[model samples]
Each structure stands twice: as structure tokens, then as C-alpha cells.
Target chain A: MSTNATTEIVPGWETVIGLEVHAELATATKLFSGAPNRFGGEPNTNIDPVSLGLPGSLPVLNEKAVELAIRVGLALHCRVQRSVFSRKNYFYPDMPKDFQISQYDLPINGEGWLELADGRRVGIERAHLEEDTGKSTHVGGGGRIHEADYSLVDYNRAGVPLIEIVGAPDLRSPEDARAYVSELRSILVAIGASDGKMEEGSMRVDCNVSVRALGETELGTRCEIKNINSLRSLGRAIVYEARRQVDLVTSGGRVEQQTRHWDEAEGSTHKLRSKEEAYDYRYFPEPDLVPVEPSDEWIESIRAALPMLPRERRRRLADEAKIETAAAALTVERGMDDLAVEAIGLGADPVRVLVHLENNLADGIGSLSAGPFAALIAMEVDGNLTSTQTKTVLAVLVADGGNPAEVATELGFEAMEAEELEVIVDSLIAEHPQDWLAFTSGDDKERKKKAGFFVGQIMKVTGGQADGRAVNELLARRADA
Target chain B: MTEYTARQRISRSEVAHVADLARLSLTDQELDAFTNQLAAVLDHAADLEALDLTDVEPMIHPLPVHNVLRPDVVGETSDRNEVLSCAPSIENEQFRVPPVLGESP
Candidate 1:
């Protein structure tokens, strides 16, 4: 099996992939209780009777969870419909209620489409709401769940609201699967519904991979791969699973439908269990809760509150602002897209604003507001200070939080007098007589190359405080003299 | 009055699987007895099939209410010690249970 090559290793076998993403909604309280919906607290401290499944306790649906779900649905272009809650009956120790309250037939968001960055559209089957289970820690026997002597259940995470987004089996490769997850994660974070942290298990993915003969429209038996924590692992698992299935079917063996677990340390998937005994979850409507039918006014309000999503923002930056693809992606991922847009809206140069925001500085642009940032760009553009000095001023504004001009003066970025810069440029031109002669007599190509050398000399003597454009003008005048 | 029209019998293995999922340790004799009793319950409920329920949607919950919700405000979290008092076993303030075979898929 080739790890690097997902391009037809077995010759005539195509892989079909789809993903199921489970994202925890960013709500203050638990889905059905007043327990604080938080992460990494003392075990079981963020629990209430409703979350613990105590007898005679009824669940009160969290209105904010529903609103966030609607926002996510609209972001995914899904139909926000009248949905109902169902009790998924099972006897898991992690589930204190002995059943999970989830949506069965009618999910809140239905029939949506997610367009990848490359323009491949993956249909969203449904995004349904459910309550999360408690976290279980396996104790003893190397802490592996299969061999542990005992398990401890922390109900703090129980009853956290989750929206499971199921994608249509339209993905054809491992890269496509990764792209789908990345795109979905950005949208989740953009809408402020989830933190979209795969490492923290705030967002999780279950990948279903299958392989079929080339040009075969009918699908093959798919083995679901779970326990994948990172996007890199998702790509690796899909490649490995597809090859495993293709080799099995092509070599006189049949693919068995089962669930596998991806071991990140081993870089391989192990068979968790065979899906021979089909689980009849015995799903029925939850008796303790009623249906959710959002009024048009409520739905419209949620729709109206949606911020500009990642895709639209990226498109605007690329098409209108002429920002590069990588820079636009970085700005959006860091939540600096709006700041750049605001700076540009204040008549700042789009190119300069994008460069500063995408510079990966020590302090984020969020530390300084739009007005201060625009002023810094304006100063740099007007030749009051060099680009380096402008960055220093921006840093002080971010770290110490003050007016940009005062910080610039305090940091000695107040513009050098014209004669002072002239003296520096004159000395550099005289010292580099050979390069100056070559630049004056050389063709446009050589002149353009040596122009940078003269500018470098002047900036080096002035500790990068002299503006490069001003030094260039001075050097051009000296050549004419 | 309702009359039975259709009642499908359940297999013994099916009964055992259901018991396993429910975490009930049932013996062969208990399984045999409960299989018969459960089939009787199903037969009794099959009387509904005799009436034309095709036009009527299946009632999920017998309630006229919909959209029962509460505001997203922090009320009161139960005391950890008080909540753990009801558990049969506790370790580090968490409920301890026998090691699970594995997580369900």
C-alpha cells in the first residue's frame, strides 16, 4: 500500500468516501440542564440532576442550542425544518439515562450541500441535534478500554448539545474527505457555533470508506473508520482502508462491513468489531420532550444574525481586494478577515493591510482596533516611517495598548528629517561608487537589480529606519547628478 | 373491544440479545419464560393492526405540547458530593463501573 500515492494504486479501483462530523455547540449551559457546559473541570463537578438522569427529573431543552443549530443549518445551506427528539435506547454506562436523546427521522437541518474550495459539492444528508455522553476513563490494564479492569464515568460532559452533520457519499478520494472536513470546520468556527477543535474532541469526525471497480456506479461494502483525531490521520486512514478493501476484493476475497479504529501511533486501523449483530437501537420519540417547530420570525432572526461566512469572505478578498489565496485563508482562519476589511473600508491600502494581518506577528491584530491599524497603514504609505518602523509601532500598540502615533514617537519611529535621510543616502552612493556607475550605465534589468543594493546600504546604516521608497528617490536623484 | 389479527413470534436468540443490550443476566430458563411472555404482549398489541391505522400517523409521545424549552442561563449545579452519594461505587468523585467490553459502534 502506498501512503503518498492515492492515485489508482491497484489499477481500476476507485475509492468512495463520506464523512460524519460531530460538533459540540458553543452554549453556556447543558442541553437539558443548568450545568455549566465547559471543558476540563473537576470530574463530575459540572453536573446537575437533569444531566445525571436522576429519577423524576425532566429535561428542559436549551433554547440557545436550538438557535445555534439553526445558524449552523443556514450556514450549510440546509433546510431548517420542524424536527423532533427521539430516545435512542441503549445500555451504555457513559449514558446515565440508559438512552441518548437524539433526532431520528426528522432532523433540524436537512438536504444541504457543502461546496469544497475546489468547487466539488458534497450533499449533506442531515445535521441533527443530540445530547453528548459522559466521558469514560478506562483504569488499569494500560488504560486501554478493551483490557481495563474498571472504568470511571464523568458526567460533566454529559448532556452537552451536539449537532451531527452527515455528508452524502459523494467524496471520491482521501484528499476530498480532508477538504470536506476542513471546509466544514471553518464554517462551524465562522458561525460561532463551535470551537472546531479536533484535538480537544470538541469536534470529531467518523469516516466511511469504500472501494468499487472503475466506472461502477453501485457502491461496495464500506468499513467505517472512527477514533480519528486529526486531519492527517483522516487522510492516512482513508488511503489505507481503500487499499485494504481493493486488495481484498481483487484477490478472491469479499469485503466485510465492520467498524475499525484508527491508531495514530501505529499509523494503521484495527478491527474494533464485526457488524454481524445489527443493533436495533429501538429508536422512538422521546416522551419527556416535545417537537421543535421554529416560527418563521424566529428563523428569520437567526438568519439575520449570521456573520459573513468564510467562503464568502474569502471570495471577496480574492476577487475584489486582490489578496492572494494563502493570505486570505490565513486571515480568515485567524479571525482577522473582518479587521482587514474594516481597515480597507477606512480607505487603507488593501495590499498593505493584508500583508500586515498575514505576517503571523507575535501579537494578533485583534489587540489593536481597526482605527489604529488603519492609521498605521496610512503612516507607512505616506513615507513618515519605513515599513519596519510601522510594524514596530503596531507591535507596541498591540502589546502596551496606546495610540499608534504616541507609540511610534516613544519607540523613536518619528520620521527622520529629509536632510538626515539625504545625508545617509549620499554617503551610501559615494561609498558604493562601482555599483552606482553600473546602475547608472546598465540596462533596465541591471539597474533594477542594483537599485535594491543601494536601498539595502542606506537602510543598513540607518538601522532600517529610512524608508526604502525615500532612499530609492534619493539614489535616483544622485544618479541624475 | 380489540381483536388480535397479526402477531409475530420472537426467537430465543433475539430475546437473549435484547437482554444483553439491557445488561440483564438472564438464564436459559428465564429466557424461555420471558420469550413466551413477551410474545403474548406483542400479540395483545397487534390488535391495533386490525384497525385501519394507515391514515393516522404514529403518535410519538402522548402530549399536545411542542417546543418545550428553557433559557440558556446558569441556574445551579448540584454539589458533587451530594450527587455521588447515590452511586454504588465512586473513585475520585466519579461513578465507577465494571470495565466495558468496548465502546458501541
Candidate 2:
């Protein structure tokens, strides 16, 4: 059955999508121990007895992980109720502890909504907290383990606190699913809960995709694509998997429910396992970790502490700062929106601040290190330097941290007083008599052009110390006379 | 106290699948052993179902913490020599090890 070409239409095709995104909580220590939660350490160096699952080492809940989890739940509009930790019982060499301590039936967060860019809202089923497993590097050639060599395990990431967000089958297309995941990551970053770095395995996503007949009440058989590292890969995997399923169904064949691997290089999904071959995991309550009950006051405090989320802050920037949605999005995209606001509070013009942040700062300093750039914008807005000189001062600040004023002074940006600017303008008009005569004899447009040239010369001679606005006013008054 | 029973048990084959996804190597015997052990452990969780927990609230975290954040300051860690001394392999002020095949030089 074919429907509208612009819209998705298949006689019996409805895309069912759900996401299980695991975001590594930004904490200094592991979820159940004091082991550092840092990435890229000497293999297994970040481990402790508790993280390594040594006998007699009991897991203590990291207070920071819980706070971050609550902040995440609150940001997602999830219900932060009492939740219990259960052992997702399974034996794996990477899972130092054979059982993964996670929350099952009663998760920490339940039932939230994420508003998509298309103005569509998707339901968040549940977001629960758990610890991460160790990293395993498969050894030998051809990239196949069965062929050869022993695997080396790195426990650096093991036991890091992770919050897994599960979404309902509300995503209609791959694009919508991608947008939802992106927004979710942005929200997590904004709330200061997770780094949301997909490349570093800090944030991971698994997509559950299936296609059913249009107007069908029953859900279609779904296959899960695991560990999608990037947003681009996620959308590609969904499209490829959905089309594969549709082809299978239309050919009078059943689409097998399984976990598929997304080969980002090959741009296809390879069957990892089938449902019949899937693991039971045998989840049970972890005996070691006690159940956690957050007080109502604690939950409220976390809720109040949540910084402005990306969507809300984006809307506010658009309305209050009169910035475009895209510009507003850039400010919130990198967790620099707060710094931008702080810079504005320190006297930066909103429009110029947005422009500087989006164009110059984003390009020169990089989004992650925009702190000094924001400070430079504030300095310029405070009349410490001209806009041109602010760029120079910013470059110096990034290359070598120094006081903006000192750097500006060192670079010869000491501003000229109004009287000094008047002197420069008077000299320029006197030095260029031909331009003055042309300005007096020409039409309004020609006169304005000549006046603009004279103002530019004055600014150039003053090393941009002559305030352009004041110089322009002086030049206009002199030219009109 | 209520006695627990095992239900929805996982099989040895399922454990092996999980191990494969996790890039772990487990012998059949080890899989079988873990399956049985995990099943027994799950049996104990059945006790949670029997508890009069309807009135008892579920707890998510132990501590009542909110906004426990550090200032975004990049502080210096211990000296490089002090840190690199712990590395099994080190060269030129950096930790060096076997190169990952697909990683860039």
C-alpha cells in the first residue's frame, strides 16, 4: 500500500523505534568505588578492589553518581522516585563482577517526554543507572577473535557510573530518532551530568527498529543495533535495517529478531545474534548494594539545581537576545551558554556576543575552550579594547593566559579619549582637502561615502583606539558643516 | 521471611551469547556454571516479590546530594614522572603500548 510520497506510506508499514542510550555520568569516581572515572589511563590503572570485583570488596555507592542521575532524571522530566539496584546476572570477562548492578522493574526515572525539532514529542520509557563494563581489545589479524590471539581487557572504564535512557516506540523515521538522541545528549550535557562524548564511549546508543503494517495494532518483530557510536551512524543503521526488514517481509519471509552490529565503514548491519540466541541476563537484586531512597527534599533540591536545559535556553536566547534559533542552539550546544550569559552580565552586547561566539570564537578557540573567548568579548564590550583589538587580545589569551587589559595594552590598544579622537578627525579632514571639497559638493550618498572613508582613516591612524562610533559622529558633523 | 524460587531461568547457551557480545571468552563448562549460579542468585530476588513492599518505597540512590559539582578548573595533576612511573610501558614522557591496528599513527 502506497501513501503520500512526501510522507511515509506503506500499505502495512509503520516504523517502530526505541532507543537505549547509555550515558556515562560525569563523576570523579566510579559508581561503586573511589576508583577514578577518568578515561585513557594506563590499562587497568584506574581500578580498585571494588571495581575489579575482588572477593570481600563490597561496593559503596558513589554519592556523586546519584546526584548526577537525579539531575539527569529531572532534566528529562522523569519521575525521580525511590529505586532499587538489581544484579543483571551474567558472566563476562569484561564484567569484572559477573553481575552488573543495575536497576530493573523500579528504575530511578520513569515516564518522561522529549520534544523533537519537528514539534513532535517522544515518550521516555525509563532511564536507570548502572555501572559500566571493562573495555576488551581483541587481538590478532582479520579482526576476528575465533581466528587467533588472546584479548586484553582494560578496566579503566569499568565501574564508571552509567545512566541508560530507554525510549518508547514513538519515533516514526530514522531522522526523528536521530534528532531525539541528539537532543537527549545535548540535555545531558547541559545539565552537567554527562560529557556526552560519543567518540570516547562516554555516551552510547542502541536502536531497536521494526516495521509493521499500517494501521496494525500488533508490533512488528524488532532487531536491536548495538553501540551506535555516532549520530550519523545511528540514522544510517536505522534506514538500512528498516529497509532490510521491509524487503524481508514483502518477500514472504520473516524478519529475524536479533542484535545487529553496525559496521560504520561498510555502512550495513551484520547479524550478531538472533532472539532465540539472545541472553536471558537473569536479572536479580544485587545483594551487596543497598536500596537507595532519595528524600523528597533531595529530589527537589536536584530539580532546582538543574541549569537551563538546551531547548529552554535556546528558546530564551532566541526571544531575549533576538538571536536566530541556529545561533541560540550553538550557544547551548557546547555547554558555553552559561559562559555566554556570564559574559553578557559583564557587559557584552547580546548580538555581538552571539556573533563572536558563533563565528570568531567557535573558529579560533574551539567550542570546548570558549571561556577566555567569552571573557574577551566581555572586555571589548566594557570598552577595554576595540572589536579589532579584542580579536588580537583573544588570540594572546588563548595562546598564553594573561590579563585582557595588559594584553591589549601590550598590543597598543590603549583607547584614545574623545578629545584625542577629535584631534585625529580634525587633522584627517584638514590633511585631505580634496576629500572635504568632494564631500561638500556631492550628493547625500557621495557625501556619506566620503565621510565614511574619512572616519575609517581616522580609526586606522588611531590604531582603532578612536571609538568608531564617536569618530563617525564627529566626521558627519564636520562634513555637514 | 519468604522462601525464593527460580523462574525465567537463563541457559548456558544464553550466557555464552552474552559473553560473545562482551568480547569475552568463556568455556562451555564456565558458561554452564555461571548459568546455574546466576539462576540460584535470581531465585533469591524472588524474595523481593514476596516482601510487603507495596507500602515500602523503592530507593534509587543512597545519598541526598544535589549540585555536588566542582568548579570547571583544569588543575595540574602530579608530575609526569610520578604518573608515568606507574605505566607498564612508557617512553618520552608518554605512556606507550601496543598500537591498536585501526588507530592513526
Candidate 3:
């Protein structure tokens, strides 16, 4: 919302933000273990020897997880290469293996670009395959969470296939970060790689935020905000954190490199740790698992099978409609772009069709075929039905497939004849000559107000079935006379 | 013994830090003994490092295989009750451990 946030917050200060998104690949089994990779189950019910980190249990890579990761790589325009898995050593209660298998130096997907909804391309550094950790529930100590006596953990999610997407620090505003995640989520879902559900923790985000004076070449030290789950939270947290950094710098304090946690309820960020105490995740390649070298033929097959991504789909729809891509974004997001495009192809007014889609049909695109949808638009376009009547007919048509005309007639939504509307408008003008004078001679704002008054009077007489556009045309003719 | 004494490859403090990361409690005597013992292992590795093999490609594993993947099918899982019975602690059919308060939430 703050396009000029730089001026608003200490004139020269500019905020820099980068995002790291972790999405769970929709696979049947764990990344390296045979345990079920599911969202929720009875605790420990989905565990295997590998998931539980039992002795003598070795991990074997899941082919489907690899394929899904590859799908993500190709969708992001990355080079899918042979990747090695490294053991990130750390001690955590939820990590039964005392280490997480992740991609360290060599990632499967490297150097890609994700285009924002506004056609701004953000550079993607890498998207590597990894395993998710188990869920932990802190028990006891009620209000004082740090004082909790113990923690309970469920291993159901352990070893679930995950693709950690690392985005370059290209985002400046918080809004762009939200757009990046939303755009990325749609791509993930459209390609059938991830469900992209942040609420369920299937998709997670961490942002690295820093601020420096505008046009300053050197980058500021960034603090990593971890586990931001929702798009709204991502924006709000960035705004708060950026201001926090700006204030700290202005107060003769240095911004230390650290990991911070966003407190949604407090609308502030709290320090989780400083760089000094950061885990030296003694990273070494996992000896148990072999390198994942995907063949070129297999990569081509995945690339061939990808459906049209959301970006190209939005671009195509916007080009066909001859409108801004942002205007067609919602229609595409709701999976109605094809329907809107097809209706447009059938000579339906693109603007009106898009407007109808934006106003109505939000719940669903309805089972009504493109032909009927086009016919309905045509009826409205020809002034045979008011947009309101068109909506009434559309509801029935969407609920039940039938002729648009028949549906209109069945609903008693017959568009008023032009002569009938003309007669009503003439009489109303004669009755209210003073208002008509204001409408004709008044300023632009006054005319719009008086026009609304006439439209209201006309709709009252016609039982809301008159075409507003037709009534306007009749009013204009009468005013000229 | 002579080979290990040829050079003190690993320091005692480094060994102590590694032991600390593993959460292993060791006395000063154990640290001194392990430092020399572990230095011998590093000495052998230093010999390999000394070899001129710049042309040889770096290999992470000796397996003649690259991709050893299994089908992503939900197969056998450990019995919850049986697994819980062997655990150090269990609460609400889940693994129970002392509350971890550190780098991550």
C-alpha cells in the first residue's frame, strides 16, 4: 500500500527482502523412507524404521519424490541436475536421526527465474530436495512455553519429501513478497507438484529482510524471519521488521545477523538467536543415499507433461482480451481463464465477460458450457437483458445447463423493450424537468449524481428488469432534445 | 605410534568441541588420549590428501550406482504400540523428550 515507503520511513532507507519457501511434494511415500508422507494421522502410525531412525535402517530415495522435485525445477525454469544429499548435523528432539538429509552444495534445480504477477522477474537461486522434520508439541507450563517440562513429537511428517525453494533478494516491498509466494504457489499447484496449503503447514516461508539507504551499493545485514505461514502474515511481518531495523540503525545501533521469529499476535518480531550461537550444521554428504542423477530423457518427459503454467495462462488470456494481465489474473487464478477465453472467442464482449466473471461466478465457474455463457453475454451485450437480469439468468444457467434465452424467460427476466424504456424515461424527464436540467447543465459530478437518481427511478418503475445501459442511452437522447 | 607423532594433525580443543557438539561428556584425560588417537586417523587421511590426484574426479561414494530409488508406495510401518514400548519415554502415543529450548521453536 505504501508505494513511497522510503519517504515515509526515514527518506533514504530502503528495505530489501528475500524469500525461502519450503513446499511438501505431493508424494505417496517419504523422501528416503517407505513411511507414508501424509499431513495428519494417529501419532507415530505412519512411521517406519527409517523414519524412526532405528539402527540398521538405511534410506532409499523415493522415485516419485524425485520426479515431483524435478517437476518443480522445470516449472521454475531451473536446470535440473544430478544432486547430492548431505546430512545436516544438529541435535533436536523431533529429529530422531540427529541430522536432516538436505542438499548442501549441489542442488537438483539451480539458477531459475520466477516472474511476478506484474511481469517483474525475481531471480531464483536454487530449489533443492530435502526431508521434513517431525512435528513437536510443547506440553505443560501453559503460559511460560520456554519453561515447559517436556515436548511431545509425532514422526508422521518426518522424512516427507520437500523442495526448499531459495529465492534471491530481489523483492523490495512486502507486497511483492506476497505476490512472489502466491505466484509460486499457483505454479506449484498448477504443475501438480504441491498442494500449496500454507495453513496445513504443507507450504512454509521464511524471509530475509534488510534495509539500506536508497542507491547504496553495499547490502545491509539481513535478519532471517522464519516459519511465516500465511501471505498476510508475510506482508505484515516484513513491514514491522523493516521499521524495526530502520529504527535500530537510526538509534546508533548495529543490526546483527540473527534469526528472528515473527509474533503475529503482538505484530512484532522477537530474536530467536544471534549469528554467534547459530548451529554449525556440520554438513557432510549422506553416505547411505546415492547421488540422484536424473537422465535427460526423463527430464524432457516431465517438461513435456507440464500443463500451461499460471504466468503464461494469464499472459495468454490478457493478450486475447487485450487487457492488462493483472485484470485477467483472477479469472486465471480461479481456473476460469479458459472458460472466459472461450466465451470471448465466441464473440462475447471481453470486458463484459470478465466483469461478469469478476462479479458473479466467484464460488465456481459452474458447469455451464462456453456456448451458453457466450449466448448470455450476447443477450446482455445487445441490451436484450440488463446486467442484473443477466445475472439472474446466469444463476439458473449455471445451476442448470440450458439455453440462455429460455433460462431468462423461465425466470421471468425478459429484457424490457426499448420503446417501453423510452416511454418511461420520457415521462420521468417531463415529470422532473428540474432534475433533468441539472443532469444536462450541471458539472460532471452533478451529472453523475443525477444520472444515478434517474437510473434508480427507472429501475423502480421497471421492476429491476430494464437494461441500465439502454436506459442511460434513452436519458442521453432526451437530455439532448 | 611413530606415524602419529610425525605430526600433530588434530588438536585437543578441536576434539573437545566435536565431543561437545555430540553432547558427549569427557574429562581432560579422555580429551588428551582421544586427541592423539584421533590425530592418527587424520594422519592416514593426510597421506591421501598429499597424493597428487587433481585429474581424478571427486567421488562421494564408491558405489557403481547413481540413482537407487524405490517406488513411492505406502508399505510396511512400525507398530505404534511395539515401537512405543521400546522408547525411552512416551506420552499420548508420541515420543516424549525433555523440552528443547534453543535455535528453533
In model 2, the runs with Cα more than 4 Å from the true position are: A1-14, A146-148, A213-218, A321-327, A334-481, B1-105
Candidate 1: tens digits of C-alpha lDDT, residues A325-439: 5457767667777778888888788988888887735257647888888888898998987777887788877776677888888877868789998887777778888998899
Best of the candidates, lDDT: 3
Candidate 2 residue A299 Cα shift, in angstroms, is: 1.2
Against the native complex, each candidate's DockQ, computed on alpha carbons, is: 0.64, 0.06, 0.70
lDDT (C-alpha, whole model) for all candidates: 0.85, 0.74, 0.88
Q: Which number leads on TM-score? A: 3
For candidate 3, the per-residue lDDT at A381 reads 89
TM-score of each: 0.83, 0.64, 0.90
Give the Å shift of residue A115 in candidate 1.
Answer: 3.9
Which ranking of candidates, highest DockQ first? 3, 1, 2
C-alpha lDDT (0 to 100) for residue A460 of candidate 3: 96
Residue by residue across A331-357, what tens digits does model 2's lDDT show? 676555765676666655787777766
A1-481 in candidate 3: lDDT tens per residue? 2233543334678888889999999998999877888887888999999998888999999999999999999999998998899999989977898999999999999999998777888989999999999988888887334778888889999899999999998888887888899999999999999999999999999999999988786889999997587999999899888899999998999899989988787888888889997888889989998888999999999999999999999999999899998888899989999998899999999998888888898988676788999999999889898877888888887887889999888888777887888888889989999999999999999999999999999989988888888888888887888
A209: Cα error in model 3, Å: 1.3
Supply candidate 3's per-residue lDDT for A55: 86
Better DockQ candidate (2, 3): 3
